[model samples]
Target chain A: MERLMKIDRRLLYLISVALVAVTIFMPLGLPVKVSPLAVQTYDAIQNLPDNSVVLIAPMYDPGAAGELNPMLKAMLYQCMERGYKIILGNTNWTLGVAIAHDMITPIAAEFNYVYGTDYIEFGSKPGGSVWMQSAQTDLAGAAIVDFNNDPIGQFPLIQAVPRLTQEYIAAVLVLDCGTPGAVEWLQIITQGTSIKLIVGEIQMSVPDSMTYVQSGQYNGMIAGSRGGAEYEQLVGRPGAALKSQDTMSVIALMVALFIVLGNIGYVTRKR
Target chain B: MMWLLAQEQAPVPTLGIFSAGSVIDFAIVLGLGVIIWVMVARARTGRKIPEIKKIAGLEAVDEAIGRATEMGRPVVFIPGILSVDNPQTLAAFGMVSHIARQCARYDTRFLALNCDPLPYAVIEEITRQAYLEEGRPDAFNPDDIRFLSAEQFAFTGAVIGIFERERPAANIMIGAFYAEAMMLAETGSFQGMIQIGGTAMTAQLPFFVAACDYSLIGEEIYAASAYLSKEPVMYGTVVAQDWLKIVLALIIVVGAVLATVSPDSTVLRDILGGY
Candidate 1:
């Protein structure tokens, strides 16, 4: 009982690593059920007026790539399928835009979306929330150049939406991880505007983001990896998030078992 | 009639200083400043003010350091992973000073680990000052104040490696933390070290609360410096911030109720939105 109570953490780590490896190689294909939130998120994007422009900000870096990357890809696919004019970018997190740019290239090509007309990548801007404030007032002045460093004034999509406002933008989908992210967008551009704010959060930030969703400040939210898988299912395109559901479930169950074992050992020993 | 009238008179937003919408934000900040000034005047005159409530996590700092001293093991302090500009990192400075002073008095090994280079420079000097103030300048080892890494995981990896090697008796983590909170807290727990963690980061709070012996949540971290030092002026500043929170909370509740009762009303929304 004492041994169980104080089980070597290294042994537990080894077991967890091995389990993760095994599950990845041979997935259980655990079914991912689409939740109401996922449905609402899908509807929020799908129900945007035909050919409306939307900006999707991937506000995270490589540390968060495992969870947020799939959310970004799924959202991009949905927007492209609906023939919405997509504006992709972020601020402060430079790598996020670069990572997202690579993901969108092949998908945009698949949808026959033109580079400057149908979609545009602003890459990663500087100044975090300050950049958001600038973009809200004057999109072209704030961005100045596209992902390729080409002059944005020459682009038709940039000319169509002069600023980030309800008059031009239909929705703002944010793959949020930390500060100067979804909250900044909500505070700066989207709140009290007709332009809907939808966010995709990493598991760590889901609790904090939920308040906005509950308060109706955020129109929709894709919760986490579980939410990501469910969203992928809704989009009818299964990706990394969908495939990783089995590993997540197994890990969760393993953790729960460990907790139970430790508690039982402690309780019995107390007697 | 109102809806039709609004559509016809769709107001063009003005680009100006002191716009009607921004007044509320400005007013609140100005109010906080006024409150702070008043409190400071009162504190200087030895006027009565509400006592800062005891924070158990902060109160445990001295005991945790003493345990390390008695056990002849190092005390590890990680002042989060952010630069000095962050409010949380600034809040951590006083607590680190108190810890370093206590360690200097007890002649215990003190390790001040940093993730950001800017804070590393600041914290190193702060630790040195603490030792100097304790009249133990010779005991202060410059090597103990190490800048681990600027990268998040790299810093975390380095801290864990240190924990394994040094086997510190106490771990004090305060300031802004992200994903590394759990990794560090759990490692400390397994080592059976007395752990105290504080951060305003909502996402990382649960990990600290669940794993650490003592956890400071949200504003408690902001109040730590004032409470630990019991400096009246600092207390006044923290109290002013608290008053502002209360005022903001009231506004939020009233706004929520107004919006709920009358869905069509944008009076409060427009003002608060700063549009």
Candidate 2:
């Protein structure tokens, strides 16, 4: 029992990895309980005014891609289904726009969405939140060119949405994992504006993002991967996230079991 | 629908007196300043101020250092992975100063590791100053105050390597941390180090609390310098912050009640959003 408290960390890591691998092959088929927050997030995006222009910012790097990719896909599917004109991009996360671009192109094609008129991708920009500040006034000036390096002023969507304001964009959907993310979006473009801010946050960041949700800074939030799965279900697109629920459940139970074992050992040893 | 026709970057709407969003922030800052000033005045006049609750993480600093000294092992301080511009990293300077002075007095090895070069440069001078103040400038080793890497994972790897090699008895980490918090804290735990962790980053706080023996949460790290130095003037400021927090809490409660009673009303939101 005392040895349980001193379980070598390498062994613990090995067991966790092995468990994850086993679940990948033979799924546990656990039911994922959808939280109220996920429902709120779905409704927030779903209930937007017909043909509303939405800006989606993938505010993360490759490191967070595994968790956030499904979220971005589900969001695009929902938007495209609603026939909303989409503006895809971000600032500071250089690699993020490319990832989002790949995900959006296929989804847009499936929806028969036309480029330049129906959607435009402004690849990543520099200057973090200051870029967002510039975007509020002049969209074309802030984003000089489209993701293809062509002049954005030619696009009808760009012409319709001259600035990032409530008058133009109805909502800003942000998939965030760190600084200069959804928080920056709220502070810069949305804050008191009628433009609603909705966020998809990583699991680690849900606690911090929930504050904004409660304060009505973020109109709604998808809490994490579980939230992503719930959102995918709501969007009627059961992608990779919904399929990976079994693995997550098994990993969660493994962690809990280890905690109980360690605590029992400590308690017994102390006595 | 207000058409934002002004194509160029429009200045924040100044309804003549002040900009729209600045109203609440301006009022809060002014009120906080006046209150803090009064508290400082009271302290100077030898009047009583409410004592801040003791923080276990900070109190254990000396014990951790003493343990390191007895074991003849190094005491490693990580000021987090962020630059000095972050307020949390600035807060870490105070702890580093105190810890460095203690290490100097006891002639124990002190190693300060940083992910960002700016904090690394700043912490070097801070450690040197601590040693100088303690009349042991000769004991300070500039080489130990190292800038490992700027990349997040790279820095985590380098720090983990240091732990394996140095075998530090005490590991004190305080500042703005991200995902790297867990890896660093867990490694320290594995080495049987007396660990003290702190950060204002709520996301990273759980990792620190889970892995570190002692953890300082949010505002506690901000109030650390005041707690360590025991200066009356600093105590006054901390108490004033508490007073202001109480006032804010009341406002939130009142706002919630008003919002619930009149769901359609934007009265509170408009006033707070503006003047």
Candidate 3:
């Protein structure tokens, strides 16, 4: 019993891994409601005039893949369905190419949304906020080229599309897992522009982003996995995000309950 | 009519209990709340405890603030990038208040750079109260509490600029930080400011630890306000948090034992597994 109480972290980690594996395989078909933020984001995409220009800032890395990817997929689906053109760019240097080359390609193919017509991914731009301000002023000049060194302008989609300023951008969808992401859009462009902005932020950033939502600076914000699940509900379809909600709820309740019971045990023993 | 229709379509979300695993969670929450109430009652009845373990990151506040005061430099407090509603940020602001009072008592200036507008308003009041508490309400400079642009890197860039221009002696960054965590701490390091960083950002903890002179990890960030303020309610909360930790430890132990002893036991797993 004493040994169990002081079990090493590696063993604990292994057990946790096993638990996660088991849970993933065992689906509970959990019920989820759409968040206002996700619905607003979906509506913004759904309501956009077909062939409208959307700039997606996928500013995150692999660590946040589990949280942000579902929202990205849903957004892509909506854009393709609505016939809006998307310009995919990254603020994070490392994850930018992977997102452009690996994630978006097959998904776009599934929708038969041909490259250079429906979407154009202009790989990663390294400069953080400075890059955002530059992007607002000059899009082609800012992102410069595609995943291939080929000029972004060479692509039929790129050549035809005007540069992204307040005038050209229909909406800015930011999937952010870290700082310097949505804040870049909020500060650099959205403050004075007519371009609508929505953020898909991780759970931790929810409270902070809510202040932005309250201030009316951001159109809407989808927070963490829960927000993504909620967005799925609003779309009248369910995906991985919906299933993940139960897992999250279960985990949160587990932790909260354990904390409560532990105090009771301690107090009772003392008495 | 639209409002009524919208309400009809909207399903009320289940507030609690979605799966069998939820049973454990409900039990835990209920148990902990009861324990906290009992503990507070006992304390009120005058049961004094021994000195608790020291948190080194906490002890350095006086040194950090004193150094800033001695150098006739302002103590720059980044109350976090998040708003006042976040429990972590709110707690961090409480500690910032104590530090601000120290700065006032020493006749040193206090500078707070904020990101969110709402929290900026709340923190402005916190700074004001600190100066008033120190009997130097006149020293409180509302402008010193600035609403930097709310964008993440934009705010970070501004903070970087503040460090360059003001050259504050101590940089106390206590809140929920992310990638910009390193950017802020590294900038402070370049300026030769004694940097102290604290957050519940588990992934970003390593960056702060590497760059900062002192770093508060995990629950320590939550405990900071209580430790600094010495208020009874805050102390009571820490006691609650401690009880929570012990319960968590026990759950993990029991869970490990059950899995090892009977890997194939559905009943045991049900008793343990979440929804």
Candidate 4:
């Protein structure tokens, strides 16, 4: 009985794993409130004129896919629904190209969006920010190959679309999951360009990103999963962001409860 | 309209409340359940876990305070410019609570530079609670915890000014940071203060690593709460997180193997692919 009374960590682990799996699969819905940032980002996209060129720079990989993918999906849906031309590219390695190809392509196809006219994947650029800045100068000259590594000129989409330097590119949204990221956009390229900057940062980067938003440097910004959920709400499509909130709430509750219980346990045992 | 917005399709019968219901939701709820179960089991067993290794960044709170005490300078604790709603900032709040207590212990003056209005008020309460917890409630200084501008670089500039006028012996930065990370860290480094920093920001982790003496990398920032409390519940969460990593590793290994061998297998493809 005493040994049974003794905590079996393995059992605890089992219970947690089981519970988490159950919650993830189950329908215990969490409440969602759209944040101001998400709304602004959504409104910006929703309000854009049809067939406007929207550039999406998928900056992070699978590690941050958990946050960026939902945001991208939501944004892509918004763009496709509104007929926004999306030019998707990345500076990261194959990880990013794979993410863009696997995640964004299918969704675009579902929306019945045509390649070249509606969207083009520039694949992975040669250099990070240098290529980004240079692309602003000469779109075709800079990107010689498509995401598939085919010649850019071969694709009518690349050949037909006017130079990115001329500012036909509507809004530039950098889904930044890392450093030398949004800052580069804010600091370097977008300084005098007509291109509006929308930064989608993970939760940890909010403090600094919020600063830019408050300062009015960024036209729109999305903060982590919560912001992503709120943006989905603003777009009138409750997707994974909204669904992830249940997880967030549960995790928050667990942490808060543990804090309280741990204190109680500490005092009691010491006494 | 609100009902329309919250409605769930296909899988679940429940009307969406916050739009937070999904498989991830189940995982989260389950993760919490496990933590609670472990804590209960630990409490029942009466097995006391050993103290975790002191986080140098946290331990330096007292050392920073002591330096401030000796130098007759105030200790500046920037609880990050983020609001209380942010988990990273919330962790910073937890650290603030401890720092405030240590400041009280050393009789050293402390100032909390904040950018977000909401978190500023919370930091004030955190300061008061820290004093109260240390049995020096009267020693709590409200003037020390001040709200800077909500703007990012503007907040960085505010901290810079505070450093100039007050000439703090130590600058401790914890929580969510972005571009201004370098601005603040560089300023403190220039002032030659014993700067300790930590953030879950993997990208900015490099900057902090290059600049600060002791920097908390990815998971360590989240582990701050557990490390500080040293409570069985918090410790249990760390254990759970470890277990999760192991599971994730296994999944990755299995996934890599299957994907490598079969390449075109439906099961492996489905695992890699998502809804």
Best prediction by DockQ:
1
**Chain B only: TM-score of model 1:** 0.87
Residue A122's lDDT in candidate 3: 85
Better of 3 and 4 by DockQ: 3
Model 3: residues with Cα > 4 Å off, grouped in runs:
A1-271, B1-23, B41-46, B49-51
lDDT of each candidate versus the true structure: 0.88, 0.88, 0.75, 0.73
| Structure candidate 2, residue pairs in collision | none
In order, the interface RMSDs are 9.1, 6.9, 16.8, 17.0
Per-model TM-score, in order, reads 0.88, 0.89, 0.53, 0.50
Model 1: per-residue Cα lDDT over B188-241, one tens digit each: 998999999999999899999989999999878878878886666778898887
Per candidate, the number of residue pairs that clash is 0, 0, 6, 14
Candidate 4: tens digits of C-alpha lDDT, residues A43-101: 77677655567778878767678888888777777878887778888764447667878
Order by DockQ, highest first: 1, 2, 3, 4
Please give the range of 10 consecutive residues that has the lowest summed lDDT in model 4 chain A: A1-10
lDDT of 4: 0.73
Instruction: List where candidate 4 sits over 4 angstroms from the true fold.
Output: A1-271, B1-21, B40-58, B231-233, B266-275
Best by TM-score: 2
List the DockQ of the predictions in order. 0.33, 0.25, 0.03, 0.02
TM-scores, chain B, all models? 0.87, 0.89, 0.87, 0.83
